[model samples]
Target: MDALDIVMNKDKAVPYYQPIISADKQEIEGYRVSGKVKGEGEKWIDLHPFFADNSIPDDYRQEIDDHIKQVAVSKYLHENRSELLFFSLNPNLVVPENIEQFIDRLSVFKSQGLPFEKMVIELKEHQFEGDVSNLKHFVQYIQSLQVKVALDDVGTSSTQLDEIALLQPDIIKVDLHAIGNSPFPSVLTEVLHSLSSLSRKIGASLLFQNIQEFTHLNYAWRHGARYYQGSYLSKESLTFLDKKSFTQALNKDFHRFLSFEKKKIKSQIALTDTLTKRLKNYLNNNKDFSDIDQVTKEIASVLSDYSFRVYICNEEGIQQSGNALKDEKGVWQYRVEERYRNWSWRPYFLENIVRLQYEQKGMLSDLYTDIHREERIRTYSYPLNDQLYVFADIPYSYLYEKDFLL
Candidate 1:
């Protein structure tokens, strides 16, 4: 139905609950309340489009939104539910003028036996049109009432990390649908990792939505997601479901994910061991570290099957030897221009150097995109001495060939 139809029949607007499953408990932690209107043949038509449309009058949309919340809240209280009730609020509508009115409405619910602590208000910060400081104040006020705030559609378009850090919402909702549709999915891994790190630092829980398959669920689990939602686990319903509905299934899936991750870690450790053994054998046979260029080329040749490029650097991250690069035709070539380049600005450069020094062993890095190759790859770094370190770039093609390496 069109906006006019939905608006004209606003009384038909009803709340549907989508179950949110917790990663730790492997059970339904809460339900995200969404609007659905009774349409032709008494079928439930989603009101997301109507609410998302900016051209519609704010008052008209607000009326329907408020109605849905009232109905949902009454139903929740009647059922005596203890789980969290997530209500999505339009950030544009939450201005300073109407802020108190909104709080008063929540207070009315609190008077009706609904606990403020169980209420979660989800806001899409990217859609906020007014001054962010105002929105921040509104969130702070609601949180003061013991109501939790959740930033919705994070890690998507126009969601800035600075704003997230500033607002410091209690939960950050990431849309897995966006990641599945991204052209460069690998880039999103970095984005999710950053989001994950930010959430941990800020003490916010992560809720991943639109999870439609096992891969999406696994992605959410691996990226530190605390809560999960979407059709993969359960569909939105007119009534609340049993809290333990998906416990058995989630446990089975978690087992599979854990097994796969363990295999990947074992693969990385085995590769590190193999590289250390070969490097130790080569170092025992040849001791002339002064010929840096020749030494790098020899090492690259010895590990050519695993690495596409090899280089030596000092503890200060200054390249001491030229890059030994493998050509498309499998010929090894030395690029002396790369020598003397300072890599101290790179992430984990110094930390890995220190780790290598203290551990006195080889280290395998997490998967990342290589700027030069424009491909997903891993770097294996080994300490040659206190002052020098050798790094080998493992190509994406090789990792893809190995089980659980990619």
Candidate 2:
């Protein structure tokens, strides 16, 4: 017998539930439905690998998918009518040719008083093949039934982004690979920021998956994630938890995170204030300075431990001096030929310059990746005079040391 036939004949597929929580960690927003097949000696096989295996016929795969959904709806969802149901499907099995029949089945659930609005159909990201326009039409038709759509296990690929735009899913599930454990986590932070911006533009929410630690949860909360799921919250099981106890535990964790964050924000403000005061003093003392080298030397001496590079720019955003960089040997080096680059196109360069020119006050930018060094850094810009602005770039390590980037 075929693998699909064996599994079907044995009736081994069983549904498991994993809770997805709200951003405030106050309530259970939904439950993701997964499946597992029991083995001879109590070993369980995940249904993802079974559906992923190419040897399984499309018909059999569709049947299994439909069966899981039908069972979950008929049993668990029917009982708990308040919370949402996140039902996923392999895109390969739900092609344009068979999508109409799938829609008919979903409509049947709607007729039973469980509307499609409460059901989020998650589409496995990589299985998005076949006709693109036809898939777009299928998404539109299902949405017309008031069913919300989601892109599951989304990665940071351009193709995946294009698919997201075309499908216009209501939620984007960030894969665990994109948010893995790392001491620095700068790239993961950047990817999350990019995804957050995209979701905001498309009017969709973000759901971070595989959040197995407090570090991951901290990152997600800071980046505006509204929905979350993983072993950190709860393991998949046949039974659900009492809503009151589930929310109470979640609230305790949430409050703990908030308490730490409040303390960190105060430290961030104090650090920024100290640097600003020192910068103002140095600029004031060097009012008559003409040589760029002497100015860089003085600035480096004052903020040596906090900054790595320093330069001067004019109101027109034209670089007036070469870059003074702190080298690996712990000494400062000047790059004389690195001048004349334009900064007018940067996000806050012109705005900050204008503010400094008018207010004669210094400004510090939010944490951002420096294109030249490809590292996270914050730039401090102070008005040296009406025409010149001194710019210093501080590496992210300093802020991280103060627990500001958590």
What's each prediction's TM-score?
A: 0.96, 0.89
What local lDDT score does residue 29 receive in model 2, on the 0 to 100 scale? 82
lDDT of 2: 0.77
> What are the runs in model 1 whose C-alpha is more than 4 Å off?
1-11, 181-184
| Model 2, residue 230: C-alpha shift (Å) | 0.8
Root mean square deviation (Cα) for candidate 2: 2.8
Given candidate 1, what's the lDDT at residue 265?
A: 96
lDDT of 1 by residue, 220-240 (tens): 999999999999999899999
Cα lDDT tens digits, model 2, 173-285, are 88664556755367666666778889999999999888888777776777788888888878898876655446776677778878988886776667767877998777666
Instruction: Provide the RMSD of all predictions against the true structure, rounded to 1 decimal.
Output: 1.7, 2.8
Off by over 4 Å in 2: 1-11, 77-80, 156-159, 177-179, 289-293, 354-360, 371-374, 396-406
Query: Lowest summed-lDDT stretch of 10 residues in model 1?
Result: 176-185
